[model samples]
Target: MANAFYKVPQPVNEPILNYRSGSPERKALKEALAAYKKEALDLPMYINGEWVSTDNKVAIHPPHEKKHVLAHFSKGGSDHVNAAIDAALAAQPAWERMPWQDRAAVFLKAADLISGPYRARMNAATMLGQSKNVYQAEIDCVAELADFLRFNVQYMTEIYQQQPNSSPTVWNRMEYRPLEGFVFAITPFNFTAIAGNLPAAPAMMGNVVVWKPAETQIFAAKLVMEIFHEAGLPAGVINLIYTDGPMAGDIVFSHADFAGLHFTGSTKVFQALWSMVGKNISKYRSYPRIVGETGGKDFVVAHPSADAVQVAVGLARGAFEYQGQKCSAASRAYLPESLWPAIKEKLVADLATFKMGTVEDFSNFINAVIDERSFDKISSYLAQAKKDDGVEIVAGGNCDKSEGYFVEPTVLLVKDPHYRTMEEEIFGPVLTIYVYPDAEFDTMLEQVDSTSPYALTGSIFARERSVINYVTDKLSNAAGNFYINDKPTGAVVGQQPFGGARGSGTNDKAGSVLNLYRWISPRTIKENFVTPKDYRYPFLEEA
Candidate 1:
């Protein structure tokens, strides 16, 4: 008889009791989580074309638990940060002067290399280091990284050449200039892809980059450095460093050669960086660019005609994917009173059926949070919800941080739409639901706009034409990225711009043409074909 094909195991719901009581797969995940807590890969910091090993170490925890150290990351001081800045300064001119086609080729090769074997390892690292689920890890760290590089190069090359309205100029030529100096980048752990592109975007445009990746995801960031180098990127063109926040601040502000910063993190961090820029405003040789994408409190609105199955699945994936740590994750939902009970029933049923396990468990729907800080924050939010008069836990309210930074998927129902639970950004697998009276549709939208200090992202689910049109117009400004009948994540690199306005930081939409524009300083090099001494314009006096 022919040998049978052994297919890979798909994620399924078994009667696995708690974290301790599952099959051998679950047992292995537990073991890995336990081992990672105590023993982690030692990551290096890069600067000035050298990978420096540091003696000082910091602990990394799987989001399932805070006490467990998933990895030990090397921490660099101000000296290292300054060295990277200097390296970026030295490399900027050459990188800028390189032909655009060459730069595009380099990034394209890098993307291909990353998507190969490097892609698998990257996905695994994201799962362990950042506590992302299988699909989330695959997309954000591996797939999305490749896409960001490839599309940025292809689309940017096209945009660079597609400048408009040069016709009928008998003796005129136009050219664009790269920024004068180095670009600095500070990225977060939520999406390693964002970290890669924040600096890659500027570097591809001929600017040298100094990147400070979040300590939580240092190992993955280090992998990026390895992949770029393997792809033949010149040393000093893109420098990656691991450091504390203050050290990063000192370097970016003190370096007179620094031209810009591409940041994705908390709003507080952006504010502090902005303050430093202001302090050094007079000392800098040129105006520095500060582009940021901070926090968000995204929403979802459901109308009666909306497909309950579709909305439930989208909301479940949006709320629980990456353990709801994304800036675009849906944390709040508004359901019309007529459809509220049915939606609630489906959501609860979906939530109950979701299998929560380690990323190694391909069937697992939700993985751990990123770190202990995330656990504490989400835990604190739940504690606060217990005391809130109008808030009730509709789904999960339990947390287990003994082995990893893990919190069960949680849903909160608010009796009053104006409750605190509805306003704050509870960045985790926590969703707050509120019912809107059918007659109060307009009023509810106004409430959504007013309640959220952040206007990062929101979704509307309705089959009715009028409902869709009305919500789109009213909530247009509600999110930098708004969705219709879909979850507010998975934005493609070239087609849709990413980033948010209001408290979500500067609207420098990450993968869009607008973002590429930020990386370059447009200098209109108008070349006059006619010799200046031999020819003169009709409006000017003859030389």
Candidate 2:
């Protein structure tokens, strides 16, 4: 078959709408939330295009209200993993042989579905299940997920059209092939976009996937699966399973057909998985691709010339949004002594005004952490801060888990920059600040860079061009997604391709073509146009 030259539509970042008071989006989201809350959603595992059920079903509840059950998903087992792998192997040949345009159409259509009729439902599911407010839900489920779908399609076409230069008498063609085996996608609980994108990104490039989403995120993950189903994603292209991760891992990692892993989660878990893959390397047909974005102790550093109020806003949003569950959230901050007072005032005011509870209330800026474990973990941090002499609880440090796993957005002012809280990756709404002399900006930058093993996302605020340049250069390896005069969170798809180095991840830079490359293997095809009837070369004959 001859390939035709084709170009994909340029992807644009999906816009996040303000679901403000009396707005249509607010009204619709409220309606959807109410409607979804009333119903008992039985989320099933999708294997080979079939919704499969298990005897062991786990009840999933909203973190904001622990008693309120949002959905029930089957706890899959090793048998389910085996079935999924069988299905993927059965479906791989025809699916990979299918036209590239055909594969691209599925994700593009899924993006449109997310943007149109499914927008409210998707956002509502995220808010209800994940405890994200309207704005957070809109940015995650409605915008970022759609961006992943659309941008991935564009990237697929781009990957396909990259051809090698050939001699005048020869024509060289290059083809991007899917992996020889299925990819295993392990998604985190924080972002709905990540839950969908982790699996779908590889599937868009003609690979099958065995996806295990965080048990907490199955509510919205079900909706994403439905959208992909509606978009006519072929059977076994991306199978979803809700199971004990380790059980699934045991079967998948040892299998000869395990081709790759797409992961977004904790550092410990990722490291463990990597270690497992390494130990079982000799048992596999090929080395599995390990791509992960783990934990981050990201930071925000402000110079003497920086606007304290603006810096305050940046820290508040970056450190506390979604209770700072984001991998890129700013947990450590360095502030000049001159700017701390003003920034502190605004930050304290913002924290005081932040309404903490469930996401149903539109005015509530903060919500509960994921579950009791997260609640207990954060509560322990608060408890430790109260006893620690070097740190002072400046804004808020409170936890009430009677009805929900709620932890207030807490701020810590530490005398020592190397304070435990400042250097660690606490994936919660706890921001640690260290005051430095205004003239010691260079020294402070070096300290922040060396403090954390993670190099995920961070920001620097400075009005002086020279100072900005210096900070940018000095802290280049500290963060992969670096910002100027802005917060470290909220990375837009097309504009800021997100990923980080060191312990943070493989630095694949998701939301761009770079990540898509990891899923594919290239083959070069060369055809000689000149007739060669004789076996000997001209030099051989003459010599």
Candidate 3:
């Protein structure tokens, strides 16, 4: 029986560890990385709290060192997808019935495990498997993942505390119930934090989940499931399966009990899933909630008043970090003709200083792209830019994939604002800059707003308050998470409730209470204090 309203531990953002040379964290991380590199793991599908293996194993290789094998994950098919869904459905009743505090405890413990003992292992996995540098891996897999877990618990409690106003004769309350069926969580490859959070969010809200992580991400994802299991997540609460996307979607989307989708991937995939759900709407037990954070041709627009150094730094970090694989990475920039020269000089200097190599080398700022496919795609863009008369290679246009998928941090100065590189998402360490007339800041803002179909993230750099205010309002609909002076990439969990509307996603604002609301169905309960003998209103008294 429920006795008290349990207050969860106050949520705080997990502090990022700087693995500087000679630091204990650096030493520990180095040891972990070496350990991971020494052995090749045989990973398995986590279903119903069991490690399920199969003969169909896919080899995993580090993007920065593709010659070496890191792990091989057992890939499942339609049968495994069906089995995962079945496990989730079977576990739904007891899992949902579990106390919210108990549910919160599970993830909270997972958060602690992530930040404490499991931190280095997680970071090492991300570095080796996904080609993230030490700092990037720490911020992503450890700090950010912990933040999502702890902060989401706080958000869930806040959601449950919301109540309706009660009348003098009636007591009214709002009950936030978990959804009728299971949730499907399709996570991306770039962020291990996202891979962990996508399924964990809905499961924390008392919903069962069938999680499908990208093949490229499964190496670290295995560690995530292990941490969840260690933290006491119940069997079948979150069934992690490896399978073909379309095959899994066919079963999940067409099922009558399909409840919702928690997705982070490309715009095309999200749209296709949405369409499939729409087509099969009649088959579902209830309206399925679709929440997605999709693709972006994110921009960084600089004003003449902006400091050249600031703009340069923003572009350097925002556009090139993690090889610009982030959906929020700044792929396009519009610089004023007045400040272009200084910005260009500083940006080129920064690019020149960046050392590109394997993630094992802490001195290297740049690493390989995720795979050969991404490498080829990005190389094609660079190739076209080199051939086109309308663009100039400003700096770093070299690509050598002889050893690994290495594409140099490239910059293109485009004559046309709507050039293919400027409008399209390159998803690599490539930034396309278009120099507009210094006097045409307003026109450039309009162009920025209209250039991309995505409204995910964008940044505007200006010193003047008037220019900042005007540009902010003008490009209000251009980005979901807009930045004034900072880069658009590192959105903190509790601080920035991240999401965007108008093709980017549903803009449910993850890291806030808004996202938790999506996984629940609320029912209002009203009990009359006094029973009326007559079934007539005051108007029936015939005054």
Candidate 4:
């Protein structure tokens, strides 16, 4: 019997469940959080479908409540990374040879698992471990992660269906082959969806992966491993590691079989890795494919006609959600002189209403920054703002690390558009405002474009149609993900297609077919229907 050609259901985004005080979702989540708090998980490195333990360990804690011990994971070293690469190389041929439909089923099943049974576990883990509130956790851990899995399965089929046209006398077929060797996925700590998508995206395209996640994110990343295993992903397809990133990069970048890097992290590390790869370019059997999405100093701009209430809400939600740790979070703003007063008033009121504490409280809108390093960095910026003559701390400037790494959502008003806070990426809940005369909106737009090296996400708020069109056309290269009247953060998987250029890493839009294409190499096969008795071809005949 011929194999059945199956079509996956079109993926719609998972809806965020409102965890209101009396709601069922809230009660269930509260119970899950409480249960998780009492128990500490011991995580082992995953290799060749087996749990491997090591003497080196790192403890993970909730960023909002730093003293609470959540989990500890076995740390990987060069030896472990080497073993992982070997295992992935051994598994690559078999995994790639499996039928495409069969491969699609595994990821589709993983989406189902995330949508159903694994929902609570994923959300709760992100809320506690990553210090996101209930709503933020729901959107990232449950909704976006499931969307990547579901949509990527459909995308894989789409990639397979595309083929070249052929003439009647001959047949042309194209094969989408996995890369010759293994992919190394280096993930960041900001998003749970990214943690799941980075490694699985490559593996879904039939490439074996040696995955390493940020230490702070191991709690949720380990859960992602469980979901894939339950969905019947075969052994050795994706090997998860915990280790020093530099050490792993040192070994993997120089290896003969190193085929690609699937990464989302800081710009500094990505650049360092790129340099190392360049230095060892000749050592590899084939040139490695480099795909990465890195840091951004995103912005929000208000025209004279913009609404103060909406602008205030956008800045609050965009800049403070998850403590503004997202690469797409708004870090700078350009406001008209008249609009600044109202925006300042409304933003201060909104900041006053925010309840800051642990994620266990559903009412708290803000949480702690990621770790001590992040805390110190943000605090240093606040200190500089307080001391410098170029700025004023308008809304929030409090920092308390007695319990958790908490910094108040701060705003700085700058006379100079080129101030350091206006250009640098703080990666926290700090926004710099530069006010311009109402006549200088165009000039301000240009200044906003030129102030920062990064161009990841940005937004423009204007009710005037002409002004909107003007900014849209003028700031065309300002951001990869541009917003109309909305916030730059919270990009839906299939909708916005997130990425950026300039100082940003390669604009490989994740959650799209472009990103998946990186993991596959194409081969063309042609056959002639007619065979000639003689070996002479038409080209051999004299004209």
The lDDT, on a scale of 0 to 1, for candidate 3 is 0.94
Residue pair clashes in candidate 4: 76-242
Candidate 1 C-alpha lDDT tens digits along 1-543: 325432212212111122334554335444544454445677777776677888998876655545545677778888888788778877777778877767777877777776655555666677777877656776687667777787777656655775545434343434556677788888898898998898899888888988988887786788888888777677789888887788678867877777898999988788988999999888787899999999898999887778877888888888887788899999988888788777778889989988886776667788788777778899998988888788889899888887777788999999888777678877898998998888888888898888888989889999998989999999888999999999987776655678899999899887767888887777655544543574667879767
Each model's C-alpha lDDT? 0.79, 0.92, 0.94, 0.89
Model 2, 1-543: lDDT tens digits are 647766777888887788778898878888999999997788899999999998897999999988988889988888999999998888899889988888888888999999888998999899988999888988898899999989888888877778999988999999899988999999999999999999999888889999999988999998999999999999998999988899999999999999999999998999999999999999888778899999999999999999999999999999999999999998999999999999999999988889998899888999999989988988899899999999899988989999998999999999999989988777899999999998888899889889999999999999999999988999999999999999999998988999999999999999999999999988889999996898987788654
Each candidate's TM vs. the true structure?
A: 0.89, 0.98, 0.99, 0.98
Q: Candidate 2, clashing residue pairs? A: none
Model 2 misplacement above 4 A: 1-4, 540-543
**Model 1 segments more than 4 A misplaced:** 1-40, 65-70, 163-170, 532-543
Worst 10 residues of 2 by lDDT: 1-10
lDDT of 3 by residue, 231-303 (tens): 9999999999999999999999999999999999998999999999999999999999999999899999999
Top candidate, metric TM-score:
3
User: What local lDDT score does residue 142 receive in model 2, on the 0 to 100 scale?
Assistant: 84
C-alpha displacement of 144 in model 1, angstroms?
Answer: 0.9
Question: What does candidate 3 score in Cα RMSD to the true structure?
Answer: 0.9
* Between candidates 1 and 3, the lDDT winner: 3
For candidate 4, give the lDDT of residue 389. 94
Question: Between candidates 1 and 2, which one is better according to lDDT?
Answer: 2
Candidate order, lDDT descending: 3, 2, 4, 1
Q: Which ten-residue region of model 4 has the weakest summed lDDT?
A: 1-10
